[model samples]
Target: MSLPMLRASRALSGADMHAESHAGAYADSCSSAGRVVARGAFARFATTLALTGALFASLVASPAVDAKTAQPKPVLDASAVATPDRYAADAAQQMFAAGGNAVDAAVAIAFTLAVTYPDAGNIGGGGFMTVYMDGKPYFLDYREKAPQSATRDMYLDDKGNVIKGMSLVGHRAVAVPGTVDGMWEAQKRFGKLKWKQVLAPAIKYATDGFPVEPWLQKRREFAAQNFGGKTNFDAYFSNLKAGVVFRQPELAQTLTRIASDGGREFYEGQTADLIARQMYGHGLLTKSDLVQYKAVWRQPVTASWNGYQIVTAPPPSSGGIGLIQLLKMKADLKPQFDGVELNSEPYIHLVSQIEDRVFADRQQYMGDPDSYRVPVDKLIDDAYLAKRVEDITPDEVPGAVPVKPGLGDSMPEKAQTTHFSVVDKWGNAVSNTYTLNGPFGSGVVVDGGGFVLNDEMDDFEIKAGVANQFGVTSGDVNTIAPGRRPLSSMAPTILTKDGKVSLVIGTPGGSRIFTSIFQVMTNLYDFNMPPADALAAMRFHHQLLPQKTIYFEPYHPIDGELAEQLKTRGYTLQGQTFNGDVQMIRIDGTTPQPAADPRGVGVGRVIQ
Candidate 1:
């Protein structure tokens, strides 16, 4: 079938898409005070009074009834949460109802996803968190670390060639996880509820079981086919089917231990031993590595664009820096995009040109700051960005601007990462994105730990210039080394206006994460679209390596005219499914407006 024909058949109008996306949402808005008023009845009475001049004048002269005196207002004005699953969203609401804040809700949601959305929400994986509290921005780096026995060429053949799939599958692919530690650290620092209080819901779900959704059931079938006898995957996940309740008693026990004894139980206690045993002869991780694992609190990367502040994850994630560059470059070259309509042929071309350059810089200069001395300041400098786009023009494609790192000498980061955005009534917000590198991680479930371990080893550059599973490449700055963190594309971002959080947003799409975020930001801030329309809008991605290729979501294919124009400009147009699963919340006044990506079966709820 032709591309245009397919688009016409499948593409939904903005209003239809928004309605369909939120059809499964738990609630549009809920008031906790339990008081209900009939606005329609009040309006009818007011209309009747208007018909009688004397009565209307008398009513207008009297003071209006004080709502507070008539009925007590709810303790919380408003709060919101958006996640990739309905179960996780419900868990977050549970924490909020218990007097917990955004941090507590986030911790609860993450643990709940470990049981319900195992594809990416995992306790055995690692990721970054960007927090905004009390007008200050903070970043947490709990990304998985390479084990002590890791080497520069651990995934290479003796003949010096790359060993395909070695870094992607099996026990050898596992890395020391950091999610449990990360959650613990976040709660200890900012959470209001007790640790056990936040974990109660996840334990209940795992012990009693929840019905499997279609997405999760498909993942189970895939795991059975690909990892049937490779590990203990089948023993744990093979029996799950759509519409059936799936329980994990072993995982419940593990969560129970961690809740009772604290995060230490997962590191220095019995859970650590189970992980060590799982990797006994097939992997390099050990009990010692687990004992030494610590999630670090890092300074968030912050930059100002127009009037808003962009606070996002810093290196080892190339996202924060890369996002800053994309915005600044677009701002610098504003004249080129002045008259171009958004998503129009000219606008996409200009954006793609800027994206290609930023990604080229990402490949050469991004990595774990702890391992490499990344030249962050030099890379995102205003002068440097201006020079990078000096040659860009609107009418024609510029000859190859050398695809090299912008700085003469620089330092330095996929999909399956799940993101959830939360906001409490107090205005505190948390944007978190974590992953296991791929679905079900390395497909190796620990004997007693009962969770999948991350194959984050594949995130490192197995060989400089060679693409990993996500088609993203990196330089020597990201080579494997003991205790070193791998470069990541997980960009958990928060935008603040006038020192107050205005938006909380992030997504999971491996290499497409940051770019997807970039587009959503433009859709909201630049085009002034509603939150639902912004999230439901079609998206595009352009990484540097694939020459002149640009990928768009297959379900929301590009317009025929736009596609033809892009092709005419020496660009290759590719349609790929599932561009991103973006979970976002925009704070309008004191109310939080939440929107979940229509592409995924997620939920967004507003609590009043």
Candidate 2:
């Protein structure tokens, strides 16, 4: 057990305020004007200082790293990233500028993110992607699956009851990996760059070294508790706990091998051998399973929302179904509005109703299309959508009413994953979402792999109402079966108008991501708000699981009777969780305006 060296990148302005007098210098100095006499002078000084502070905070929190050093010039060009860190973005951007299409760039960047930011995402995670080309769109479904040896009752307890499956630690909690194979397959088909070139950045970051972003550091600190005190994990976290930078040399070397050999190197080469050995020695992964693992690249689902055609990942990616389904429901209501109106009851009511129906469908029949017989077309059909919308009136009921959602029948929950979106100069766009299912992804980093493996297979319903590791339960629709892709909410979405891309967008908020982006797009096109304002607008989420409507305060940003109009709709509201990270680019004619969500350290780069 050894601590890999780390590189923590940061620029500190001294330290936390210790002495009040000096605190005034860094703090109140920013706005700490007291009754320093002339009293009136204080007000003016305070205002100026406050403004200065705001400017400083703006830059510090800005997604675009200040031109501080010779780090690397960004060439992402209207590229927005929501990966765990900047290194991921850099690796991705560098690839894009080097002639790699979004496919090449994204795969490069994603591997870097997995290695550098392993707490929330990594190679251990599996992902979903949506690609658009010519006049059509395609959904790339390379979601992770259970090992062939995995059983319907593998997650069951002593009483033959299904316990929360893969949310915890150890090999038995693992799901067969699909990320490497998925990335390789996508890049080979759509990327302009060669597999070796596309993989170079991630390989280098892993093999050589890169600085750890503050966010990565913080996540480690929190995750340290969960890792317990295993010698290897202890060595890993002790460095992170003390603010020491950590890197993944072993993982990098493994990635380098994969880059040269492709997914085969990971699943069937030395890496797969290593993973299988660990699984067999520690719990259950079989060599046959590793050898059989391969990535899937399929067509994405398309939907029309208010005249604009949208594209997203399909089944195996419930995100596509859920995203389009909810929009279809919303469009059915025919709610009309001009300009921004956040948290207004009518707006909230309409969105909530649509969300409720969409989620109900998700619960019923959204899973891997191969194993499950999902009437995806029926689920997302306008006729069925209109029927569901007709079920809702101007009332706020408990949402428990049995809404008969069409689409054949139910499927189990798809494995969870993460998302990323990219648009380069060729007018080509890629919207992607990848995940390890949850933070730390079963909390098991593949030994010498420097990445966590996804427990996505646990997303299936081993039993009706059986809770997963995250304390979330699965329904009949999300139950598992052989060769089935589980349901998911990681939506890599986009909107095009006039045959030009209007918005390259997506987010990562479990079931809530659908509504969050839905609101953002509605705000931009339907309401005509500026990019920043549209992003800042208050939002709401309806998952239909707990059945209570959730609304962020900012969703109702405008004041006056609009607020009153909302309350009359019988809305059950709460404070905004505000965790969704949405990145988008709006094409205003021939130009592009890029905006990244302020929820974290996201940067949107324009080619100009």
Candidate 3:
């Protein structure tokens, strides 16, 4: 086993290490009447000295065994967390400071985001989390499930024709949420903090009110535009105003109940009752559905690329498997990026072809593992990935080549999700991505729960060979069934080198999540870029079934002469808005370097 090498990017200050001592220098040296207040002076001096002594003591306590230089940057010597919201990151940092491991911090971040980032971060939604505890990896699948009444053609009309937006919008769209149970389960099994303590920050944020960011307001307006006249729309948006304090009293109360009773309250108690009542005449979820819902534990999908072992969510989430497959293919092709210029024509074209090839397999082979036989072993096989790479061309674009799903001589995976990464002082690491499916998720809030319901039912393949919103088409493997989890693109991944988690990366974009995480991984490992540069780098996405074009972000420097170069080669290029808000934490040497996606308004915090 080897340790990570550190890079000098920023410096840490003495005051940043200890604030009380700096302030104590100006404290009252003597009290009024001048009784020679030696006791008070000595107490304050002693306190300051102790605080400073501990600061240095902690540094000396750890050997910095991984440090290459005589002295390493202090900034890289601390625990850190990164999330899509400042409040949520703060919650995670607080947990870490309170002697919590990555799992505990993750639970805190999960609940805090539900309150602060309502558009995607949610308790009403569900997702997959990959946890690395003591160097061993585990996966928790809390993906939202189809209701018991769900059927293969539930979203189809009489003639077996798929309903366009039927599964995306109303009460029927809501699934039995598993996020609450998922968080509780992870915390109970691997967390170091009490369940209630982990949820306290979120409860306080919801009840005491949090300032509405511009992004949240924009999302609110977007929801209103699409679902203005829908039932309960006003209830969730009545007090939503930009740049003002937005309080979720109902959500706060619900959180309070969950805190006191553990996650059981959400699954079978008051919150579930409210959800049932809200869907009584409109949705398919019954009290029984809620009570029966449970988050299952799955072994994490594993693969290797560039000396790094990868652990990620499996099966129901095609993201991880897809990423591993893509990386393997890239490694086989070994396309040199000419000084790592990712925007170069050969690099972009080769990578896009790889994406198209994998996605073609994804549309046909992936589904919930418990519901069907998924050829996970065969899909990630080196020979299979090498064969998939052969379909790609180094110079010309591989325009929509029909790549068949590999058989292990067996078989093969789609989000409006939120993702966060946490690495505590301990070696424990967590990468999680959860969501409500769409912007406001079904555009309905429970009557008294003050939470959005996930329309995850739409994630299923409504009909064979038809692409959903994320553009991945599926067969019966992903067809709706009672208690079955739909295919998803929520890829929460951890990369370990020599048995130590080196990088935790994930993102939120329906289909883009897979490509986004893949890009960042390549950027860091293959290209050897820093975490921030890796995330800030311009990205492109390709889905095989739809368009067969590589969608480039607007920020990509491929206009004018460079853009025209690709046009002559039959490369279908489409310039579009940015895709995927990725969150990453890189454990370098003795420090944790966290970086939030620059494309989003999220924040990263290094625990001091």
Candidate 4:
């Protein structure tokens, strides 16, 4: 099963708590690390909201934060393969130049970033991948599964209630990793490039080192305490210095092994032994667990919204079902989806109501199929979905959002994750989201080798009501069980028109993953905005529990006093600079226009 779907919970608003620290505490260190703001936090709104004292005061005292320096974009036409991040793009370009097709290029890009971009994706983590080739979608079950020792009660206390908080810090939280086999089997099925060729880009970055982008460098500083301590920090963060370039020799070496020998090295060879030994030291994983790893392939799920077919990450991952449910709830409303306007309160409110109603079902009925029988079809059946929408009151008040009675009140989780997208010239598109729960996952570095183990165990539903790293919650549908894959908010997707591929997309944000995809789709297919403008826009999100919209001021302002007014109705308010890295490719029937999210330190370019 995928990692246990422990619910996500909002981390402490670290808003007011970290405001001073964000500006002062890390200023010197960030500057030293070559980290610039990348982009300043968006401006604050003028409102008499209860949180106004803190919100307005911070803005009044601060100048706009510095934006990160912009990297150059590829000046090209549509046929060049488009990837969300630069390393992935470079990897694909190498394959394309070597006479490899999009499938080979994409595989190369995915493997390359697995070494270079480790915050969210890599061998430590696993996810679903949909290949658009052979004129049909081929679903691969690469999602991770629970261990042989896991059981239905793994996450339950004697009384059966979920243990509190993120399942991150311990050994019990991990599931068998399937990423290696998933990628290998995928290449066998569709990749055109030789295995070693696909692995080269990652090998180069890991060995020679890739410069730290502002966002990645900033994350290291913000979450330094979490990713590493004074001990063994260099193993994962080698050659990195503020304003100084860093290289990943260890990771490059690991990739070289995989490229030449295959993923078995990570599961059965010396590298695998290194990982097992480390896990044993930490009391978290065992060799038996790694030996049992296998990838499963399942069908992708879809729902039609105004003639456009939206495909998403399916079960094991609750995202696909969750997204359809939310859209179902709002199916009747005539949204002002004209792509030209900035995000609005009505948009935020509708999404919140949809979230509130759908979460109840998600918590009760979803889980890894190998262990639990989720009523997927019924859950997404139009009739059931319509009822979910009916629960919406169309008002911004707290209780107006619906929840299924008897299910415990919902919570949220927020783990940092990564996303990548690829669209080959042949029209096969792949959107993927992967994560290790937190930075430098588990912080259990492989001795004498590069790459950190995943703290994905924290991704389980350990404690019932407490917020984990990401604000999320989990219960029966997502509780840990042997062989069960945890529920996830990772919603990688593709949008199609008349049964043909139209656009491919994916992003990085824990609980916000759902909202980010939802909004982006609205902006594109519904709002009809251009790639860059759609990406640069701000966003707002609400998971049933917070009860209030979490707004990014610059783009999602409530307009008028509705935001301030919502406070009296029990809405919890919080704000942040723009978040979510949405990398997408639009095949407008004639050409492909790729857009990379400016909010993150990712690079996406057309393959020359």
Q: Which stretches in model 4 have alpha-carbon errors above 4 Å? A: 1-84, 150-166, 170-173, 227-231, 335-342, 400-402, 405-415, 549-562, 568-570, 576-578
Give the whole-model CA lDDT for all candidates, comma-separated: 0.77, 0.58, 0.73, 0.58
TM-score for candidate 3, residues paired by index: 0.85
Off by over 4 Å in 1: 1-76, 226-228, 396-399, 409-415
TM-score head-to-head 1 vs 4, winner = 1
The best candidate by lDDT is 1
The alpha-carbon deviation from the true structure for residue 168 of candidate 3, after best TM-score superposition, in angstroms, is: 0.8
Task: Write one digit per residue (lDDT tens) for candidate 3, span 1-608.
Answer: 00011011101111112211100000000011111322343234334434455453343223222345342223236678888888877777666665566787788888888877887878888999999887699999999999999888888898889886778888999888888889889978987666656776676565446777777777778876766566566555645667677755556556656765668777777668878998998988898999999999998999877888999989898899899988888888775434546767667777777887788778777898887777788889998788767656665446635556655324332216888898866667899999888887887777656778888998998887788876678777888888899999889999998888799889998888988898888888878898889988888887875554667787554668767767766666776665888999888876888899889988888887
Tell me the tens digit of each residue's lDDT in model 2 across 1-608: 00111111000110100000000000000010111222343233234333344443332222222245343333324544434346666766666555455566677666666655565446666777777654356666667777666666667788976554333555666777777777777767776555655555554444334555566566665555655643134333334433333434445445545654556767777667767766766656677777787777666777778888887777766777777877777667664423325556656666767777776677677666666666767878888888877767656475557554555453433343345567665556777777776656655555544455665766677677655543344466566555455667778887876665767888776666777788888788667799888877766665655555454545344346654555444445455534477877776665667677776566666542
Model 1's TM-score against the true structure: 0.86
lDDT of 1 by residue, 201-230 (tens): 675565446787777778767755766477
User: Which run of 10 residues does model 3 get worst, by summed lDDT?
Assistant: 21-30
Candidate 3's C-alpha runs over 4 A off are 1-76, 335-340, 408-415
Tens digits of per-residue lDDT for model 4, 515-589: 787777766656678887777776777776654545454545554576765565566667754457888887776
Each candidate structure's TM-score, on Cα atoms with residue i matched to residue i, is: 0.86, 0.79, 0.85, 0.79
